[model samples]
Every structure is written in structure tokens, then in C-alpha cells.
Target chain A: MNKNASRFLAGPYIIWMIGFTVIPLIMIILYCLTDGDGAFTLANVAAIATPEHRKALFLSLGLSLVSTLICLVMAYPLALILRKRNVGQGSFIVFIFILPMWMNFLLRTMAWQTLLEKNGVINGILSALHLPNLAIINTPWAIILGMVYNFLPFMVLPIYNVLIKIDDDVINAAQDLGASTAQTITKILIPLSLPGIISGINMVFVPALTTFVISNLLGGSKILLIGNVIEQEFTKGSNWHLGSGLSLVLMFFILVSMALMAKYDKEGEGTAF
Target chain B: MEHPLIDLVNISKTFDNTMVLDDLCLSVKENTFVTLLGPSGCGKTTPLRIIGGFEKPDTGKVIFDGQDITNLPPNKRQLNTVFQKYALFTHMTIAENIAFGLKIKNKPKAYIDDKIKYALKLVNLDGFENRSVASLSGGQQQRIAIARAIVNEPRVLLLDEPLGALDLKLRQDMQYELIRLKNELGITFIYVTHDQEEALTMSDTIVVMNQGYIQQMGSPEQIYNEPENAFVADFIGESNIVPGTMIRDELVEIFGARFACVDKGFGVNRPVDVVIRPEDIDLVEPEKGTLTGVCTHLIFKGVHYEMEVTTPDGFEWLVHSTDMCPVGKQVGIHVDPFDIQIMNKPESEDEEAVGVNE
Candidate 1:
């Protein structure tokens, strides 16, 4: 058989992408370009300039940025530890991180609500010990926590995968050349694993930026992210044009993030560590 | 009077349940190229790692320049390694890789730049400072690895089969390059390799090892000519290690023929192992020789003809000679008495056949 024959195997996925991704994307663009009467108007796209929409957009950006940073700060060291332990390819630690991802994402966020609620599992235990009762629920901090909880594996797997692939001999070479452990990590490990790091940032940041589900469950009704606003625009307000317009604005940020990823990771080799 | 530059005193290492180095002791002189030569799993690389501080021996002290440094980490040790795969930092440029040690020490930028240039120049990679390590060929990477280590101006250099990855031609060229680098650096080198030819060509002393024990350690010539046992003789070069008996002082026997030999000290009829190089045997008329044999096989080997001669008793000898003897032809096997090397029987083998030479 010709080796190119294997390319035919991707036929189903290509068709799926066209139907689910391409058509929906075209519809979104058309909706964003029109008003409710299907007449052309720039007002829906310009709605993002309003004070309420601007606050939601910046809030989404800042919160997600913080969440992505927390996930990175937490994941890189964990990945480094796993790599030092020679963990790769079906290690229990990797499986543990990936297990929560297999559970329903909304269910996992709701479970976190129970854990972080004022009179829930965590606070009940704290109060029994006469400690401070947990009250960060229905706040930006809770949403950030939920975002990190849901998306941490995305950051861990790639960084761990990349770190493990680095030859142990290279690390030994660094130490042999008079580099301390910290210097070796900074000079060799981080630079060598940059592809995975960028891929990880893209993975966690993009999803965290566009998520309305976590904020809805954890932030209650007070905080409004761009995603929550966009969700409300379509569902409760029955305004698909304004919703699609806001989604396009959100996509511009996603595209920029993706471009940043593509510039550093040309191989598209980032899926996991 | 000079003390040894590095002394590994009774070093022992074990991995899992197997002993990798069995109470090994080695002393390396300053400015000398010493090689740890053995087959894979014979614990050659382990000692080099121990010396480089990449491995800690389970027992014994690693004394360097009169200081016990068994507990020192690799970065604190005054030595560097040229790893087998040339472990250049893949992320760094050649100059950055070479300057890694200096940068860690917080050296002045000008001093670092000058050292990088000097190191690169020494490795003949002077203009390759900006080239990434991944861009270099295997040989170039090997040079960069050497340059990276030497840029630190370490007193000792540990090389763990650094040329094992290169092709034959490149490996040979790098052998000369390494010898030149070693002399130019004036550093004590603890080199590890299994290639006896490479060890012979470059090392001032060759330490032959087997089964995690030193079989013999000496000069290249001494190792080849005066192997302590059958294993060393067989490992260092091709040999016909047959069972024999030391008949008396300066006399021995093989294949029912008594030949005048130079070895003694074995009691009469004591079983021994006899070593004879293929080149030592000469072919002549059957009647005018000590023993007669028929040429069984012959093949021309570029520089000489390698032919197999079989005796009447089915004893086989691998002979390399300029004179090609045709198959099935009757020939005389002539060996000069001085060419005979007698060794003690290996401990593991049972004392059985003892052929006589007259």
C-alpha cells in the first residue's frame, strides 16, 4: 500500500470539522454581520465598546490570565518533579491528572462548589475545629479556583512530556559543567522545554478565557465575564446577533493567543507532554 | 616524586543485586591518558562516572590531589566529562554551551568570551560559536562537547566512550584529534572504551577489565605482549588459547611435540594455558618443522592472507601470513620458541587437555 493511503484515514475527521466547525463558524460570522431583521449593521459588533461589555471583557482577560499563571506556576514544578522521577508514558501521576478531565467538566465544577461553599464540606470542617469558615464561594477567587482545577492537566501534561523527553545526559552535562541545580534548570530545562510551555499556556489560557460554565457555577449571579455575558445574550435575551458579535471579539483574543503559540511551536507537536 | 592525580581507593558499586564494580582500585597520573577498557557490562564506564562525580560508589574513597572527594557533587569537582553521546545542551549555541561552566561561576563577560574563543580554537571550532548544537554533525558535536568541558580548564577530564557514535573514518580522525587535545590541555584523562585498537592508539596505560574486575593494567605493549591470563590475551587480540603443560624450566609441550620456550616456575606436568599469535607461526615443508598440519581454509585479507590450518588431531589454528597456503595442502607449522606465551588456567575452567609440543 502507498504510505499516502493513510491520509485517507483522516477523511471522517475532516468531514466532521467541516460540518461542526466550518458551518457553525460561517453562521456565527453571518449573524455577527447582520441585525435581527437580517439587515447589515455594525451596532452588534460595536456593543463591545459599551461600559458593561468592556468590564466583562477585561474581567475575563484578567481572571483567565491569573488562572493560567497559577496553573503554570503549579504545573511546571510538578512536571519537573515527575520528570526527575522518570515518569512518562502511562505513569500514575499523569493518569491521576488526566482522570479528573474524564469526569464531566460541569459536574467537577459543581463538586468544587460543594467543597468551597460557606456551610459546605470545607467550611464545616473548619468550623468544627473553630477555624475561619470558608466564604470565597460565589466570588472571582472561586471561579479562578474552578478554572485551575478544571484546566491544570492541560498545563501539566505538555510540560511533563517535554521535560521527560530531554535527555538525562544533557542534565548531567549541565551539572558536570559546574551548574548548580537551579542554574541547570534555568539554563537548560526551561529553554529546552519552551515548546511545551507555550503549548501549555495556550491550552489553559484559551479555554479559561472563553469559559462561562465555571464562572456561572462558582461566581453566582454577581460577577459577569464576557463568556457569561455572551451566553446571556443568546439564551435569556434571545439575541443571537449580539451573541455572535461578542464571540467574534472573543475569538480575536483566541486568534492572537493561537498565533503566539504557532510562532513558537511551528511543528504543531503540542498535544501532551 | 609525584603523587597520583586521582586515586579511586577500593571503590565498589552495585546496581540492584549485581555488583558493577567489585572493590576496584585505580590511580591515574597527571597528564597521562589512561583508559578503562572492557566489554559492555564489565563496569568500565561506572568508574569513569565515579571519577567525574556523576556516580557515587557504594564503598571507598575517591581521592583527588590528596583530598578525599567521594562526597563532592559533579559541579564542585575540578573535573568535567565528555559523555558518550556528546551531551551538549541542545538549547544553547556552541559558544553558550562552552561558556556554561564559566557563566555559572559568574565570570566577567570578556573573560568568558576569551575562554570560549580559546576553547573553540582548541577544538578547531573557532568560527562555530553561534551555531546551535543540533546543527553540528556527530564529529562536530563531539568537538563541542570536548570544548565545553575544556573551557573550564579542569585539571582532569573524564571521557565515557565519546567516539562510540561516529563512523569508522571519523572515529579514527577523532582519535588523533583527542590525543592532540589531551596533550594540548595538559590534563589527566580517565577515558573509557571497549575498542582495544582505540585504547592502544591513544592511552598511555590500558586497564583491561572483565566481570567487574581488572584483568590487567599496564602499557599497551605490555598488555598485548604479556597478558596476565587467557581472558586478557583473548580480549586484547586474537589468540589460540589452548591447554598445555609446563614440562620443566624454559620448556613446554603442545600437540605431542616438545618446543623450547622461555617460561618457567610451574612444577612438572602442571596444566597451563598456552597463547600463540597467528603471525608467529610460519608455514614450511611438513618434514622440516616441529609439527605438521594441513591448510584447511584460506582468504586474502587486504594486507595479508588469513588461513586456517588444522592438525591431524582436529586442533585448529588461525594463522595470518603473507604467504598464502592453498587448501588441502600439507604444510609445516613452525613456531619460534621465543613466541610462546604460557598462562595459568582460568579459575572457572576445568583442567583437561594438555597438548605436547616437541
Candidate 2:
């Protein structure tokens, strides 16, 4: 193929990307500078410095961080098991883990709400078994459980990709050289698969932070997060300026976190993908 | 009076209905080097893994220093393996890689430092301690692997084609270095390789295997000169096998001519396959030879000349000579009587006997 022809073929997507993504991002930055009275002012930016907005931002960050930790804890062993089993049922096993992803996001969230309700299947089973009835619906734990279920596959796949590619002989060599199983895992396997773990965490944390549907549906709208706050400003409050400012702040936080991750990945200078 | 450091008795392994190793038995005396030499899938590496405790034999006992470690995990076994790819911890530095085994044992810092220093020096990689392993050359990484395995001072060291990845010249150099290290460390080294020259160069004893069974086990000289069967003779080196009949004790007939060999105990007129190395067949002027042939091709191999000769009986023979012999020149081939190896012909009608009378 000629170079000119290839350039022509790439032109449309380049224009589309600049128009749809970059132009809108520039517009958002400009909007952050303008106030509700159509004047460029610091008041709109200063409004985001309020305690309620800061609390919501911190809550979102904390929730995302916790979700990432939980996902990592659950995903590492699942990835290890999938990598080590060496059976022909890998596809089936992966499907069982990922089957929840095929359903609509709202439906899955509603389903979790039904399952965690006060009179849901879980409480019904407890009552039938003559145990004290416990209420789990409309709680932070419910939100966490819902997030973990929705994002567990994303966490597992990347780690599994990295773990499966690790040379078995390397592990065997470690063992043969007198490394106990625990030492082998801590010293060899984990460090080698750090890139995968980081990628999996990013995949789980970024989406979990911006997810309001699961939290609102399962937490009974009592727990307000950054996503819920942004939603309220845009739809109910009709405060476009505040909503846009909060959106920019949320995006800034995500970008900063991602930049830190990228820096760590660079410093580690090991396999990432 | 000391017992062998490692002994495997009747070890066998079957994988999904395929016999990877069958009734394999080997014994390694303390501080001696033994090589498992065979083609790929001939159970050479399976035996090494079995010894290293990375694999378990279906029905066998692995004894290390008179202890039955058949059921022991690899970490508990007193053995370390240098895998074919080296399997160095790419995330660690050269020093860390060497100190890995010691660290696992929870050795003190001072002791690990000294051991790492000593092991690196043994492998001629002393100053390379802090360097990242990924930056080193392939040969250097291979030496690091050796250092890593030997730093623990295990009772046995298993090497699975550790030098197979190196170029020919580096591999040859490592072969001598390995022998020197073996002598210096006095640890039992169980080396595995498919390269015959490597086994012949480094091993005190060579075990030749094929199709999950040991074909022969002997010194390099014995394996090269007096292979027990056609498989060993063919596998160990280049050989010219001719179908012949044992006319009497120490005599065999080949291609309408009776020749004398050193082997005996075969009944008169019994069918046999005669094996002779190319170098053992002496060439002379065509008119004054026991086996006369016209040279069909000549390959100049630096130190020696290899010539293919077609004999009067249409048998092709390979003759190795240090002297110049032109193609199409008639030559006489004479093999030393004691150099001829005779074995029973393979029991197959489609099997063609290899003749080296080129």
C-alpha cells in the first residue's frame, strides 16, 4: 500500500476523534471556567471546595479503593487456580465467572437488590433454618457485594492472562531450588504477575468509582456517592455548572490516579500487559 | 565404601496412555557426572524431573543419600535443577537470583552474601552480582543458572539441557567449565542432553535411551566404540551398519566376502548387523584393499575428509580420512577387526540396514 493511501484511510477516524472526544473535553474545560451567569469566574471552581463535595469525592475514592482491594483478594486465587489446573474446562470455568456480565447492568443491579432485600431469599433461608433474621439490604456491604460481582471477571481475566503465561518451569525451578510454596508465590509468582494485577485493579476500580446504579439500587438511595451527586445536580437540581464542575473533578481524580499507576508501572519496569 | 548419592529404581511414567518413561533405573555415585543422552521424547528429561522431585514416577522409589524421598515435595528434596531456559528470576538482579535458594532457606545475610560471592566466582561471574539478569548475554545467564543451583550445595544437581540454548562455541566452553565446577564442588551432577558430543565430553558415564527405555549405559568410549544395539550405535554417532552373517566365532561374511571381527559367541551363519564408525574405516589404494569402492562424494570437514564410496557390491560406505581423497577415485576400505560391532538385525521386513561403504 502506498503511504498517501494509508494516510487518507486514517483521516476520517482522526477527524472523528478530534471532533467527538478532544473538542468536547476542551468545551468541558471552558465550561469549568464559566459561571451560571455566563461570566468567567473563580466562584464556580471555588464552589467545588465545599465540605459536602469533598466528602463525596473522598467517599468515591475510598469505595473504589476498597472495591479494588476486595477484587484483588478474590481474583488472585481464582486466577492461580485457573492457571494451575491445566484442565480442558478453562472456557467453561471462565464462562461461569463471566456469566453475570452478559446481563444488562441495571437488571444485574436490581437482581442483587432482590437477593439482598430484607425478605429476600437469603433472609427467607435464614428464617426457615431457625436462625436470627439479618438485614443486609440498603447497606455499604450490599454496594460492595454488588460491585464485586459486577467487576470480578474484569479483575480475573487480566491476572489470568498474566499468570497463565508464566513459565511453569520457572515455578518448578524455584521449588527445586528449595523455595517453599509460600515463598515461591510471594517471591516469584506475585512479582512476575504484578503488571496483570495492576491492570485488573485499574479495570475494576475506575468503573466501580463511577458506578451509581448498583450503589443507589442496593443502598436504597441513602448512601450518596460522587456519581449520585453528579446525577442529582444534572437531573434534579438542574445545576449544570455544579454538575460540570463535579464531572471535571471526578475526571481529574481518575486521571491523577491513572497517572500515578502509570508512573509506578514505569518505575517497576516489568511486564504490564 | 560410600553409597551413591542418588538412586532411582524402576522409575516409570505414563502420560495420557503414552509411556514417557518405562522401567528407568539409574544410579549416580557421589561427586560424579552422569548424562542422560537421548533424542527428544526419549525419557531423558523425565528422569531428571523425577530426580528433582518436579515429577513423580508411577512405580518407583527415589532415594537420596539412602533416604526414601519418593513422596517428598520438590522443595523438601535435596536437589536443585538448572532448567533448559535457565528460568532465572527476571525480576531480580544477578545477585538476588543467585541468593534465591539461600534466601528460601532463611540463611543469614552475611552467609548469603558470602555464598553468593563464592558461587559467582566459581562461575566466573563475580563482579556481575548487581547487574540485572535481563541485560546479560545468554551464556552469562546460563552460568547464573548454574550458580543459582549450586549455591544451595544440594546433594544432587540436575541440569536439563542447560547449554542447549547456547551457540556451539559457547556450549563447548561451558562443557569444560561444567566439568571443572563438578570437580570443584564434588556434587552429583545429573546432566541431560540430546547432543551426543556434549554427553561424550562432560559425562563420566553416559546413559543412552530411546522410546522410553534405556538402550545402553556405559562410558563414552564404550558407547561410541561398542554400542550394544543398532539404536545406540546410530544415536551416539555416525555409523555404517551392514547386514552380515556370522560365519564362525570372530568371523562374519558381508557382501560376498568373509571378514574377521573381534566379537564371538554367535552361531555359525547367523544374521547380524555390523557397525563401524567412519573414522575406524581405513582407506587404501583401490587395488590393494579388502573392500574396494569408487569414491562418489567427498566432504571436507576441516580436520578430516569424509568420502562416500560405492563398493563393488553396490553398498555405500562412509570413510573418514585426514588425507585428501578426490571424488570418483577408487579406494580400498579396511576397518580394524576389533572396531566392528555386531548386533541382531531389527525384526522388521521394511528395515533397511545402513551401510557406510560409500
Candidate 3:
């Protein structure tokens, strides 16, 4: 088979990527750089400095950052425990962690909203026991909670995959070479599992940063994230140009993260999914 | 001898109701190169792991330098192991892999650098400091693993088939290199291997094991020439073991002919196993020979011709000689009384036993 003819096997996938991913990105760029009259101007992109948009962007950044941090702190130890248990990738233990991902993501976020509401299940139980009502709904804390709940598996899977692939003999060699348990974890395990950690960070942070549905369902449409503002622009206000300009700004962060991923995970070592 | 450096007293281990090491005891002297030689699943590696503190025997005490270290973890023990696969940290450079133990001990940068240089030089891998471990060849990686273990200057060094991955030539070269290193460093080395020639080439003491039991422990020459039983005799080298009867003191009968021998203590008319090494048999004129046989087959064995001589009664004798004998040619085979080794028949049938004594 000649090389040119053999390349035809990927024809459908190439066309799909270009049509769905590349073309949409190009259209968003064009919209971000032009007005409704089709005249190119920087005004749409610069409109991000407006107080409402700026506040939403910062809130999204803060809430996503907190959610990513919590996911990392919670996921690392869990991944390490799973690896220590010698759990296979398709084992019931891993299936439990992935079970939540099987549920519809919006339903999961809405379920959290019900739990965090003033008279929700948790608050009702608390009041019945003469405890204080569970209070942090329609706030950044609830949004962060929803983000963590929805995306925790994103942090666990890659780290677990990487950890499981690390050779047991390497860890044994480290210990035989006089490394304490703490030193072995830091010097051997962590350094060896870096690709997975970076992948997990990218997975958790990207989704948490761009989520509008969780904020809308749990934040009562009051605490506006950048995603919510963009949603309103596209759906309610019918401002595609401004929404695309903000999306372009968000894409810049995503691109930076992708560059970091390329640097750390060139071999795609942690990509189990 | 000198006070033992490491003593594993009555060690026994079982995994899931299957015994791996059964009441095994071993002691090592300081600066001696000891080898545990056995076939696979003979439990050779378990003892090495126990000494390195990687495993705890289900029922035994590991005593090092007269202090009990039975419960010590690998990190707490003053020992290091070169794993079967080398196990070099792929994330680190060669220099960093060799410097791992030193860094953990919090050695100064200058000292660590000097130690790394010395270790690399010792392993003959000088100038590989910045090279990544994954880039090195199998032989080079094995050398780096050796350097990594030796850099710590531990009291004892354990190697678990460290050269198993190398080619034949590299394995032979590393065998000498390991011997030289042991002499230069003066650290006790406990090596585990299933290769008999390797065990003979490098070990000061060879402990032959079988089915989780020590078959024999001796110097290489003793193991080769004076095997204690049929198993040791067969395992060490080639031998022609024949069933015979001990007629009287210093006499044995085989093929209905009497032959003088050196072994003793078997009662008259008692059944015994008689061993004769092939090289010990000589081709003589038919009338001057002890037995007459026809050459059945011949193979050129580089240094000699290995001829199978069949006696009139139909027993085949494997003979190694520089002089080639033609097939079907009648010849006389001579044996010296000193070359015949008589042993008692093993109590149990060992299907794998194949060697004869000389």
C-alpha cells in the first residue's frame, strides 16, 4: 500500500475534526474580532474590561482554582491507596469511582443543588436534629462544591493509571538504597508519576473553569461565572460577538495549559481514557 | 572461622500453604562471595531478600554482626540489592540513580559527587553521569545498577541474578568484574543465580539448593569433584551412574565383573550407585583393557571427541577423547580404581537426578 492511499483511512475523522472543532474555533475568532456590521474592530475583545464581565471572569478563576486544589488534595491520596491495593483498571474499586461519571453530569449537579438548598435534604436533617441549617447555596462555596463533585474522577483516573504502571521493583530498589518511606514517595513515586499528575490537573482545571450549568443550577443565576455570562450573551442577549470574544480569552488559558501538558506528557503516558 | 557477619537461623517461609523455604539456615563470613545456586523456584532468591530485609521469614531470626535484625525494614538495614531487572529509576539520570542512597543519607554535595565518580569508575561506566538511565544498553544499565548499589558502601551487597539480562559474553565479563569489585571493596556479596557455571566462576562458597532445601554447600572444586549425593553429582556436571552391588570392603561389581574402588561402609552384597566421569575412561588395546566395547556414536566437542561406547552387555559409556573413534569400531575401555566413586542409592526416587560420581 502506498502512503498517500493508506492515509485515506483517517479521511472521515480528519474531515470531522476540521468541520466540528477547527471551523467552530475559526468562527468564534472571527466573531470575537468583528462587530455585527462585519467590520473588524478590537472593541469586542476589549469589552472584557467591563465591570460585570471582569467580575465574572475573576470569580470563575477563583472558584475553579479552589475546586482544582480540592480535587487534587482528595484525589492524590485516593489514587495512591488504589495503586497500593493493586486494583486493576477494570476492578470494582475503580468502577465505584467511575460510577458517578456514568450519571448525567447535569443531574449530578442538580442533585447537589437539592442537597445544598436551605430546606434541602441535608438542611432538613440538620434542623430535625436541632442543628444549624446547612447554608452555603447560591454562593461561590456551593459552586466550588458542585465543581469538585462533578470533576473529582477527572483527577483520580490519570493519577491512578500512572501509579499502577510504576514498577514495584523501582520502589523496592529505592527502599533498599536506604530511602525512608517519605523519601521514596517524594523522590521516586511522585517524580515518576508526574505525567499523570499533570494530566489530572489539566482534566480537572479545564472543565471546572468553563462550567456554566452547575453555577446556574446551584448559584440561583445570581452568582454569575464567566461561563454563565457567555451563556446569557449567546442565549438571552443574542450577542455572539461578545460571547466569542470572552471564549477566545478562555481559550488562551486552555492553550497555555495544553502547552504545559505537551511538555510533561509527550508520550501520553497517563492517558488511560 | 571468623565470627559470622550474617546468620539466618532456621528460616522458613510459606506462601498460600505452599512452602518456599523450609527451615533453611545459612551463615556468611565477612568479605566472602557466597552464591546460592539452584534451578528456578528452588527458593534461592528468598534467602537473599531476607538478608537484605526486603522480606521477613515466617519463622526465623536474621542476625547481622551479632545483632538481631529480624524486624528491620529494608531502609533500616545496612544493605542494598541489585535487582534482577536492574530497576534503575527511569526518571533520573545515571548520576542521580547512583547518588540516590547518598542523597537520602544527607551527604554533602562534594562528597556525593566524588562518590558518584568513584562508583561509575568502579563499574567502568565513567562519563555516564548526565545520561538518562533509559538510554543505556542492557550491559551499561546493569553496570549502573551495580554502581548504584555499591555507592552506598553497605556492609552487605545482595545481587539477584543481576546479569540475567546480558548476553553470554557480557555475563562472563561481568562475572569477573563482580569478583574484582568484591576484592577491591571488601564487602560481603551474596549472589543468587541458577547458572551453575556462573556460580562456580565467582563464588567462594556455593550453596546448591533444591526444592527449598540446601542440597550441598562447599567450595566449587568440592562441588565439582566430591559431590555428596547423586543429585549434587548429576547437577554439577556429567557423570555415568550405574547400579552395582558392594561385594566386600573396597570392592564393587558391575556388569557381572568385579572392580576395585575407594569408597567404603556399605555392607557386603548391598546395592549401591557407582559413578565414573567420562574423561576418566581411557581407550586401550582390547586385551589390556578392563572392558571391551564398540563405539556407537561420536561427536566432535571442540576440545575433544565425545564417543558413546556400548559394552557387550549393552550399557553405554560416554567417553570424551581427543582421538576420534569410528562408529561400530571395537575398542577396549580402561578405568582406574581411584576414578570409581561408590555411593548409597538415594532413599527416594528422584526423577531429575542424572549425574554420576568419579
**lDDT of every model, 2 decimals:** 0.89, 0.85, 0.90
Q: How do all the candidates rank in terms of lDDT, highest first?
A: 3, 1, 2
Q: Model 2's chain B TM-score?
A: 0.94
Question: Model 3: residues >4 Å from true position, as ranges?
Answer: B283-292, B311-316, B348-358
| Best-performing candidate as measured by DockQ | 1
Task: State residue A99's C-alpha deviation in candidate 1, in Å.
Answer: 1.6
Superposed Cα deviation of residue A18, candidate 1 (Å):
1.3
Model 1, docking class: high
- TM-score of the first chain in candidate 3 relative to the native first chain: 0.96
Q: Give the 10-residue window scoring lowest on summed lDDT in candidate 2 chain A.
A: A264-273
lDDT, candidate 2, at A174: 90
DockQ of each: 0.86, 0.84, 0.83
lDDT of 2: 0.85
Tens-place lDDT per residue, model 2, B1-358, is 7688888999989989998987878888898889999888777899888888888899989888889999899999888899999899988999999999888888999999999999989999879988998799999999999999998998788899999999999999999999999989888889999999999999989998877877789999999988877778878888888889999999988887777788989888999989988998888987667788889989899999988989988888987889878888888887768988888776664233321112
Better of 2 and 3 by lDDT: 3
